[model samples]
Target chain A: MKKLFTGVCVAAALSLSGQAALADVLDDIAERGVLRVGVKADYPPYGYLDEAGNIVGIEPALAQDVADLLGVELELIPVVSSNRMQFLEQGRIDLMIATMTDRNDRREVVQIVDPNYYSSGTNILAPTAAGLTEWEQLDGLPVCGIQGAFYNRKTEEEFGAEIVAFTGTAEALAALQQGTCVAFVYDDSFLISRLSEPEWADYEMPLQTIDDAPWGLAVALGEDRFAELMSGMIVNWHLSGRILALETEYGVDNTPFAERMHQLFLDINPSIER
Target chain B: MDGIEAWFLDLYHTTGINLTIVYDAFDRERFLWGLLNTVILSVICLVFSVIIGIIGAWLLGARHAIPRRIVQAYVQFFRNTPPLVQMYFFFFALGPMFMTTVERHVGQMVFVSETPLLTSFHWAVISLSFFAGAFNVEIFRSGIEAVPRSTIEAAEALGMSRWQIYRDVILPLAFRICLPALNNNLVNLVKTTTLAYAIAVPELLYMSNQIWSDSVNVPEMMTVLLFVYVGLVAILVFAMQRWERAMKLPGFGR
Candidate 1:
């Protein structure tokens, strides 16, 4: 047993030492002259398409920061909630700034940096006529949801909602408009963005939001050097009040989480200029 | 029961292999329900498709040219176009037309209307049954053509009415002749039930997708889904084969 264990350790050490030079993505991003980042192409205020068909949003801008840090050109790869982590794991993208929820299961698959970048809670986009005032009001009624949202099961199980999850926001919105579902249970941030539009004028986010979860940006697992670099960047972003500025620039309401994070970072290092 | 659930949870914790259906009660119940829904959907579509096939193929021999032309158009339209588009048309374009407008309050989001006469599930059934029926019509047509004119003439000469002749003589033989093709088409229809996921029917694929998305156990749930579908299709094939054998010509051997 000792011989077998030692043999396996020797093999692991040899493989690890042999590939040590190629392991650090922080250096590779600099050497490659292009940093590939996964960003949501359809989610507004995070990462989405501009009228000119270019990918623009807060997340893409953050990705550009990483590229700038490495002194490399930025390349944004469009990803949906479902495939973003897989893309990072497959090494198709060196970094991921998509609006992914930080969960223990997800952390097992991808190296989510400490100090999350953003947060959103679950809420319902219901017609004003629906008069939905409480989470319990969703019981037994059909609620449209994006397929990959983390809170879909929660809404169904806790509130007894019959979730009709669709593959995209467009389809779910159509279902909501068609009255196939009385409400759409989705991220409050995205719902708030939609409410600003003239098309969603009559709908209100009626219920109190629930299940608030912070969003984490991630790199592929074992990219510890890159993860460490991103940790510092998140701290810098908080200290500089960059998140708040981006919220204003992107027309999002300044969230309490952002304010708290900024204050917390200031306490840690009060000398940084806002 | 708790032990089994705990075992699955422990399995997930140790191996980093999460299978929510086995461990989570809500997911397991829903997954089972999803499987049942798929079975119900496939059976309903299969029965309806066969009925449509038999009727439409028989209509091809109608004394009126208009009936024949109508059948021709239906087959062509359904066969040439996509089922997914047809489902969307039925659900989005045609469905809302039947929905009565509720009290129009202010602006857009309050545009809540009642459910249409046909739900998404009903639309899926209509779309898929017709889609498979179109192919079935052609299949049954060829099966009908293979029936000898002599036997049909004998039945006609023996004072069988047009309806009786069709009911007794043509249908049974044509059905037997087309059993293999019908089996193939029914199996395809069963597989096509997955398309209902797009319209949010909560079939096996949709429910499994829900589980995977929430649990972040894509590979594990996917494996489960694959095997369940394979098992479902195998059951279908077994039943069809038995039906074919039982209905075989008395002295015939495969």
Candidate 2:
């Protein structure tokens, strides 16, 4: 048991950049000829399963870009909130495009690429009739939230929400539908998509979103080449308005974050147009 | 406690391993609450399960065939199914059936009137109790059966009623024999309380997850969680062993 715990600790917190024994993960992926990218197959528009049982979404498409750039076959590994970081750390996936909010602490675990590819803010999906216009309305009320979310504590502390965290978005959504909570606090991107769904017709994202966190796609720590390559790709995405185009294709509104990023990048290279 | 907190805070600066539950106010408060909830859940389940076990064991000897069959079926049902699934079933499937819609007062759009008969904590108690109770009933039945038939016949011949003989003669002897097995099962019940974390019970495991998610100190928080559970189980086992020694039956199996 002691040996196992030690191994787990090492696996979770190992600084491969400082280790002499570990090889460059970019070389490993190239040698294997398979760029295994972790994407959220459950989070639609970002990454979700199609009716044909194939994984496809904006993130998966972005993964395809990485694979194409590397001249490797794209392999999309479905990841959720709990396991995405671990999967990248354990060498199960070459890149992680799961909707992980970039945070300082997470930078210690996985090498998050600079210029985050996407951004989302926190909001609440409440029944339209619930009259939950203000964050203060959630005081002493149960609000469903996905486990591992950074905003769970903020919602509970600042808004006085009794955050009932579930292991996954599916479970949180189920609890919300069951009236186990007054509202479901999550990414506005996810909540907005849910509103578009016919099954969630009664529910609406009632509060103005707050805590605008950028989602950083990550690679294993110490993969400097992979990290540098991803940074360039993200810049190109912003420069070319690829993300804005993907949003339109996936039925997501062109968020201010995306538009602003495009304008910022276009300034750097004004001659380039998409 | 302040000194201890300072020590942990210093440890973070030196080693880069943050045990926030020790030093941070928010994390410590919630983690401690989680620990308390786990203890309460386990104890409630333990006491209620034992009661259910004793009643079910007593019913096994009922004169009517129906009650005995019902007990047998219940034992099988709970024993065969996974405890986790049983919890989900109780919370999601069975809980809705028992919900009573309340009248939302004085005007608003549709809001929460869906108050279920049992809360998540209550459902966890019920599910865990029934799961452990199945094993307890079987353990108790074997203990009761081990009480020599001659002793029971002696009570019957003495014109002692069945309930009287069960309460006076059989239970005392059976309980002595049941202690070791009961002790093991109770320990298991305590460990199983961690499952309550899945349903947002604010138990130790759940709170630890919250801490790690926020603090990004997975190894530190996990190591702490390990020691806490080990400590809890150790106390339980120590007490149960002491009880076993105290309740040893004279001239019975050593």
Query: Top TM-score: which candidate number?
Result: 2
In model 2, the clashing pairs are none
For candidate 2 chain A, which ten residues in a row score worst on lDDT?
A4-13
Over A37-101, each residue of candidate 1 has an lDDT whose tens digit, in order, gives 99999888789999999999999999888788668999999999999999999999999999899
Point out the worst 10-residue segment of candidate 1 chain A by lDDT.
Answer: A1-10
lDDT of 2 by residue, B1-254 (tens): 89999999999999998988888999999999999999999999999999999999999989999999999999999999999899888888887788766433213334545766677899999999999999999999988999999999999999999999999999888988888899989999999998877777788998889889999999988899999999999999999889888888677875
Q: Which stretches of candidate 1 lie over 4 Å from their true place?
A: A1-118, A215-274, B1-17, B100-112, B251-254
Fnat, 2 decimals, each candidate: 0.51, 0.38
What tens digits encode model 1's per-residue C-alpha lDDT throughout B28-61? 9989999999999999999999989999999999
Q: Write the per-residue lDDT of candidate 2 for residues A1-274, one digit (tens) a residue.
A: 3443344334324433334355687677778999999999888878888999999989999999889877899999999999999999998998999999999999999999877889999888987768778887787788889888889999988878888898888878877777777789888988867876899988778776787889999999988766766777787788889999998998777777899889987876698864
lDDT of 1 at B102: 54
Q: What DockQ does candidate 2 have relative to the true complex?
A: 0.23
lDDT of candidates 1 onward, in order: 0.85, 0.86
What lDDT score goes with residue A189 in model 1?
85
* Model 2 stretches astray by more than 4 angstroms: A1-43, A46-118, A215-274, B102-112
